[model samples]
Target: MANQTSSLRSRGMEMLIAYKNQPSVELRNRLVRLNAGLVRKIAHRVSHQCSEPYEDLEQIGYLGLIRAIERFNPVQGCAFSSFAVPYIRGEMLHFLRDRGTTVKIPRRWQDLQKEAQKCQGEMIRQLGRQPNDHEMAQALCVSVEEWREVKMANKNRMPLSLDATVCHQIDSSITLGDTLPDTYYQRMQLLEEDRQQLQRAMAQLEDKTRSAIEYVFFNGLSRKEVAERIGVSPMTVTRRIQRGIDQMVAFLQPQALQTEP
Candidate 1:
């Protein structure tokens, strides 16, 4: 089996060289088919963290793979797999960024955002007021911290443009773009500090709590899905995630003040 697989790959490389020398529709299509598994594998990896369907990501990955195939130089002495993985993943990430607001959000948080929004109107009607995070969580069968995270994710959906106006004072004018820190270096430093602080806070969590956070937030798994993986009820997953987030917030608040300019 190994020998046969190696033979197929060797043939595929030969075909790739031929296609590069004299491109044709049939040749390109055949090359795409020969390496189609690369596209599917990348799509599967991304699908776990994106709301987009697997098929859509697969299509995007295929486009990237084609671009890689076209740009690849067999003479460059790099493995094709190493060269193609980035292009495949990059295409899928770009698609998610452009179409969905999940660029900064974990897929799980986006899914939770949808679930929270679905219950908002009904909860408001029943409560005769805007439901607080706890109330919303109760209605959705999630934890308050998880509900808040969903709210935070929704807020990122339409981030204010730098070109947007910030103030209309009679004697002074301010635009968001103008208020930004003057130097690119400072901006990067601030971003890095925040990232480090978040990492520290996450590190402080217990193993189970951290795992719950990772699977539900970063991996974009639904509560039930996470529960099944960990051999617990969805409610348990919710509680663990909420507690972990709460701990993170507690740690971050003080660190944020210290890090602030």
Candidate 2:
């Protein structure tokens, strides 16, 4: 098993080098498949933290993997997996946010966050030690997952001020907002690129799957309504929409990656 793993790693590096030297559709596609295991591992980690399906997360992770492949610089002496992880996780986070995973946290969860912090401080004062998740959950009268969810929800709710200073030595005058794209042209270009990419991704989906997604997301139909329109069960329609999203992530390869000027 060790030998096989080493061989695969070596083969992946060789492929990366070849792709870097001369990018091609075949080479890029091979790299996507080669590093697919990495995507699954990340998806597993991310899926455990959220309510998203493992399969959908895995597919969304592929979109990040492809983006990483396009921007990777092997000469930088860093492992590709490490470079790709943030991209993979970022894609999953974006998907979650789009799906409304971080909407207004419930009142109970808000109270839970405050109470948990107080409880932790009290426990540490008494025990002179940090409490484990199970201990914290037990004290809070919530399950471990519930405790984690409350914390995550609270964290997501905290918004950073754009005017807050982020850098110290690199000109203290620079603020967080300064880092954002300010030019009208830049914003429009980015929006256009994103629009084109999304259109292309949707175009790549199966006709039935695309119709199901469009009816529900675009046409604002309920799952049952979409099902009736598509002549499929509501449950099947749900699966199709998820499957379509997964395919879109893979199909979201940027136009520049397809060919160079």
Candidate 3:
């Protein structure tokens, strides 16, 4: 009885695949309606690996399955399931990659993140519980808007491990904190080097241009403020800023391409 049931299922799948490949819209719609649940299940399985909403992925996956049905070639002898799995997965990934938000955070955001983390740690220690956003903002000496931006930026980051366990105590070697401090120092040194290089690059600009950039970006000043500081009209300051940015982009483009992995 099991053997007969298995044979019937296989025959049914083959017939469905054939009908789906037919040029008639009615037959194709019928085939899709029949396999709709299967397609949804496949989408759910693939979407588990992604951070995007699953309903959107399911819609994308269904479109891929429809395309697969339209393009399937029985003469090639490739099983429909094998071809459909990759097609469905590719569609969902394409949707996620293309539709997701792309945020280009300013470099100053890093400083904000560090300050927020330090404040959060202190609050947790004092309160013996997680601090609310308002409490964290007050502790960090930042406005609520700034605090929220930092919190959102770091929301996806994983927490650091607090384990004091030693991996190897063979030679009564260095403690974990000692090793961590060295790594932290190395990272700080690298960051300092990068800052120096960027500073040097900025120094290459004209004095007024450099001042405009520094006021507008580094000091977070508006164009009017920059103009006032430099004793120039706001429009002049704006033009100088644009020219400075163009030069910087030209200078950095080559370096960026070289550094890309």
Candidate 4:
């Protein structure tokens, strides 16, 4: 087994040298085929106990493997597998961070986080102390409540460990999974009902108002984002949102009260 492994490595290195200079697509594909197992190995390692689809992880890992092939230096005194493993694993991790969440974050929240970090640093230097949300909001020319929402959204970007214990009972222990919002069937049922009710209410709204509500809430966009998407001013988007909410309440509230025990 060791002798076969050594021979394969030698052949791979020879192919690398030839391909680096001539750069044949055929040679590159051959290299990928030879080392495809490496990609799967790295993918499996990175995704251990993760719920992400194995095929998707492997595809991401293949991208990293290709990157490694393009950049590997024979003179770096490292084996090809050693050089490629990090790249493959890094790609998988990057994919998980960007796309693994059940609730997809809005791009606006990510942009807001960047702006908040920049403004927080500058304000701290100017004031010689950490600025509060109100100060930050005033500097950013946003409302304090809006600033708080942004901050909370940014804070939620950090992924929590599932294995973390949420509670300790007399005879057993409960993990964070046990307490997660997703674990509640009752809550999910209620949410589904609310979603159906909202959809029905939205169907009754004007086209423009419906679009505004969908953009702001369902699409996870800010009022400004909704305005830009719909080719309207932010103030107009806000009015539409308010009117939509009022209409939804009028349409759904009586039903909700009737269902109350």
lDDT for each residue of candidate 4 in 1-261, tens digit (9 for 90 to 100): 999999999999998888877888899999999999999887787666465668999999989998999998787778989899989999998888787665555666656667778888888899999998889888878899988888777667567889888889999999987776765787889899988988899999999999998887788999988888889899999998899889989999899899999
Over 61-137, each residue of candidate 1 has an lDDT whose tens digit, in order, gives 99899998899888887878899999999988888778865337776776777777788888888889998877878
Residue-wise lDDT of candidate 3 within 51-169, one digit each (tens)? 55678888888888788778777678776678677787788878876855455445566567766666777788899999887887787678888878876766634333445444667
Q: Which TM-score value belongs to model 1?
A: 0.51
Q: Let me know the TM-score candidate 4 reaches against the reference structure.
A: 0.39
TM-score winner among the candidates? 1
Candidate 2 residue pairs in backbone clash? none
Better of 2 and 4 by TM-score: 2
As for lDDT, the candidate ahead, 1 or 2, is 2
| Better by TM-score, candidate 3 or 1 | 1
Which portions of model 4 show Cα errors greater than 4 Å? 102-261
- The local lDDT score (0 to 100) that residue 139 gets in candidate 3 is 77
Q: How does each model score on TM-score?
A: 0.51, 0.40, 0.39, 0.39
By lDDT: ranked, best first:
2, 1, 4, 3
Error of 3 at 218 (Å): 56
Task: Indicate whether candidate 2 or candidate 4 has the larger lDDT.
Answer: 2
TM-score for model 3? 0.39
Q: Higher TM-score: candidate 1 or 4?
A: 1
Give me the candidate number with maximum lDDT.
2
